[model samples]
Target: MTELLSDQRIDEALQGLPEWRRVGDAIERSAELASFPQAIEVVNRVAERAEAANHHPDIDIRWRTVTFRLSTHSHGGITEKDIALAGEIDDVITDV
Candidate 1:
């Protein structure tokens, strides 16, 4: 089982993830893609990465925008898994 991250640790991790911010006990980021298709494309890519990491995020899609929220449900808060997945999501977004 993963341990929850301390607030200070989360803060330090957030520095490297400029697009992501702390929301409650989760870390989230929203991306605006070129179109609905592009948004779905990004979501698909994120899904692949999430599967690879064995960690999934809550995804919300509206038009050309997609928001990803990462948290460890078992741990009931943020963890290193969330931070790492957020970075992978950022990389996936950059690739698309």
Candidate 2:
């Protein structure tokens, strides 16, 4: 089972993910795309990564913006998995 990240660990991870912010026990980020279709495509990529890692985020899709909030449910908070997946999403979407 996954473990919850400590406050210190979460802070350290946030340093590497400047685009993400802590909201309670979750990490949140918003990415803007060129169009709705492009936003959906980004969601697809994030879904694949989430499934592969067995960790998922709450994704909100608007016209051209996608918001992601990630936390480890089993741990009742965020974990290393959330940070890693967030990084992967950042890498994929930055190139889009």
Candidate 3:
């Protein structure tokens, strides 16, 4: 099984991911897009990245806003995978 990240490591990772926050065992980020279509586009892009990585995030979309909660479910906490995926998500959002 993948190991959980230490609190210090999680904090260090969050420094690079300013928009994401730790919530219990998961890390989450929410973005508000310019339009509903744009939000969906971001979600679709993130979905493709997530599938490619085989690490999925819990996504919530409301109107023009989308929230992503990522955790290594098998390990029951944040891991390197969550941090890496968060970076990928940020890139996708920035690109889209």
lDDT for each of the candidates? 0.96, 0.92, 0.97
Which residue pairs collide in model 3, if any?
A: none
Model 2 lDDT at residue 46: 87
TM-score of every prediction relative to native: 0.97, 0.95, 0.98
Per-residue C-alpha lDDT of model 2 across residues 1-96, encoded as one tens digit per residue: 578889999999999999999999999999999999999999998899889888889999889999999988888899889999999989879978
lDDT of 1 at 56: 97
lDDT of 3: 0.97
Instruction: Write model 3 residue lDDT over 1-96, tens digit each, in one string.
Output: 578999999999999999999999999999999999999999999999999999999999999999999999888999999999999999999997
Taking the tens digit of each residue's C-alpha lDDT, what string does model 1 give over 9-67? 99999999999999999999999999999999999999998998899999999999999
Best by lDDT: 3
Q: What clash pairs does model 1 have?
A: none
